[model samples]
Target: MAVLVGVGMLVAARPPVDVLGSFGSLLQTFLPWSGVGVLVLLALAALRRSAVTAVAVLVPAVVWCSLFGGMLVDKRGAGAAGGDLTVVSHNVHDGNPDPAGTARSLTASGAQVIALEELSPRTAPAYERALAESHPYHSVQGTVGLWSTYPLRDVRPLAIMPWTRALRATADTPKGPLAVYTAHLASVRVSLAKGFNTARRNEAAVALAAAVRAEPLDRVVVVGDFNGTTDDSALAPVTAGLRSAQEEAGAGFGFSWPASFPVTRIDQILVKGVTAVSAWTLPRTASDHLPVAATLRW
Candidate 1:
């Protein structure tokens, strides 16, 4: 029974069946929690003291280990020094209580390039005033903004969705010109009737993917509140060529959401044509989501 249940989950992750496969792909976001659920089942089996149950427990034990054990291990393998650029991405909840305090916290993070999402017209000025001192060069397109210690050029807004939640820029760093993108994809909501309502998010993701693919810059970094983890298949289009900074250099599964009890990572920093030396989550701020940061080197 345990083996059967475990195999069923494995099949869901990449079921050859169409609809079932699609639904199962969403399982990736809660993969770790699923592993825990299986462990709970193992405990029940142990309590029953059935010889067969003990053997059966190994099925999911091995299955879950094979699926996510590697990610659980510290992946901060040997890397070079903190590179020439450090970037941070955060989704400052639109209804945040203290926009000014949050701005102060984010600006204090020491990231040379900072990307903010979910900015409101009301609070945008406070952040602008707070970040202006450190980030001399900044651009706001729609609700997303990029502030850089280095000069920024070729700035423009990207219509990944109808709303102004994404933008692109070129950071003229001392090292060279690096393409940067700040994005806030459509948010998703859960309903008992529809599980994960992601139609809009998925469409926007496709648009963002096309935009990234057509970008002329060889070195590009995308930072944003992606609204879906790299683990979710829905993000494959936008994540195709880029590597996740957290997965590459963060010490653990750098979950960044729901500030207080983050369970899944929706915010992200991904890069291509560059190496990530380190990635991590910043201290909690006044927003509902935490900030994610990463250092990169060419």
Candidate 2:
């Protein structure tokens, strides 16, 4: 049984198909937690004094480390101390009771660019007013928005969803013109009857990925609620060429959902033609999702 469990862990490390109705994607989402199973098996082996079982458990332990060992290292100093630009992304819950307060927290991050998702008609105004002073230039397309300290141009909506849920624009930073994309991908759900339901999110990812591929700018930054983790193969289309800021420079897993007690990161900051010097999650706000911030160097 221990050997079989170890083998299963190794198999799961490979990209899996969604033939079992999104099971593969779901598994990948929490794949890191598989290490817990190996630990449990080791405990059982000790209780039984079974040397073979203990040795078998080492298989999965090594596999898990090989897959994620680099992340365990402290990489905050991988890039320069003051990056060229600082960006933040958050999913302020649509029903959040205090949009003003949430906006305040984001401003305190000192990010040059901030992307917000799940903005409702009523709460969006509060955010605009609160963030106006710090982020003078801003654009809100449907539920997604981008607020920037730098000037914005060529702002337009992205047709990734039926209604507006994504947008892109050019930020004339001191470093140069950078193409910025903010998107709120379709939410995913899981159930016993339908298994993990990510069809909608997957479709949105495909469309977003297409636009990103066609972007003319050499320097690009994508920030928003991706609704799926980087580990999930479903996001491969969008994450293919780009690199995740958190994965490159964050201290840990950097989970950012369910702000009360984050378990997984759905919100993301991905970059192309830029380097992430530092990436970290901000303190919880009125919103259900925590904000993720990263500093990038050109």
Candidate 3:
């Protein structure tokens, strides 16, 4: 049992989709306490004179914590001292009835740049109109859009799929050109035969990563409902080079899904060639997912 748990914990520390990612989100609320639990279990086994069990449990506990302990720290650092940008990302569930209210709440967040996904044709116009007053410069392609206070240029739809799957726009900020990507990767649904159906999501991630890599801009921000965690191996193509704003500056795990009772952070704000001073999840609104905001500096 100790060996099994040890192996499981090791595997879990690796990435999402493994037995660990599949369950870690559920256990993260008590991650620090879970560490204590592992220690206690090891102690009990030793007290019971089970040396092998004790070692097995103790060894894995130490390894797992050492590997991901930084993630448990509440950095909450100031946005890059010279940071010049504020960005927000959210998946405004296409079927949401309170599109106007949702738009109001997002605009109130005071985000200088906003990237949204899962936009429906019916609601897109409303969101565009609502955001226009604040973000005068914006671009939309397919179901994704980027609203910015800075001038937008080189707007293009990322061919993440043979069909459109993401949007990319370059914001000519005073500092320089910042490439912004808004993508709603294919959602993964679980099944007995497929376990976690991630083929489509993986494909989209690869395509987006390739597009970002090929862009001419030095500063890039990618945001939206990735439908998978940064820990997921399928997102390695993107995660490998970019930094998650929440992980860099957030006060906690920053979960943002199932807004009523968020358990995982599928929404993300990833950046490269810029500093993330702070990152946080916004209050719940009419949508099923909470918005994620980040403050950054060049």
Highest lDDT: give the candidate number. 2
Please report, in order, the local distance difference test score of every candidate based on alpha carbons: 0.84, 0.89, 0.80
Show where candidate 3 strays beyond 4 Å: 15-57, 79-82
**Candidate 1, residues 20-77: lDDT per residue as tens digits?**
5346546766666777767787788779987888788788888887876766767653
What TM-scores do the predictions have?
A: 0.93, 0.96, 0.85
What CA RMSD would candidate 2 show?
1.6
lDDT of 2: 0.89
Rank the candidate models, highest lDDT first: 2, 1, 3
lDDT score for candidate 1 against the true structure:
0.84
Clashing pairs counted in every model: 0, 0, 4
List model 2 lDDT by residue over 1-298, tens digit each.
6667667766665545734447777777788888788889889999999998888888878888887777787677543356988999999989999888888888888889999999999988988999999999999999999999999999999999999999999999999999999999998987788877999999999999999999999999999998889988888999999999999998888988788888889899999999899999999998889999999998
Model 2's number of clashes is 0
Name the 10 consecutive residues with the lowest summed lDDT in model 2: 12-21
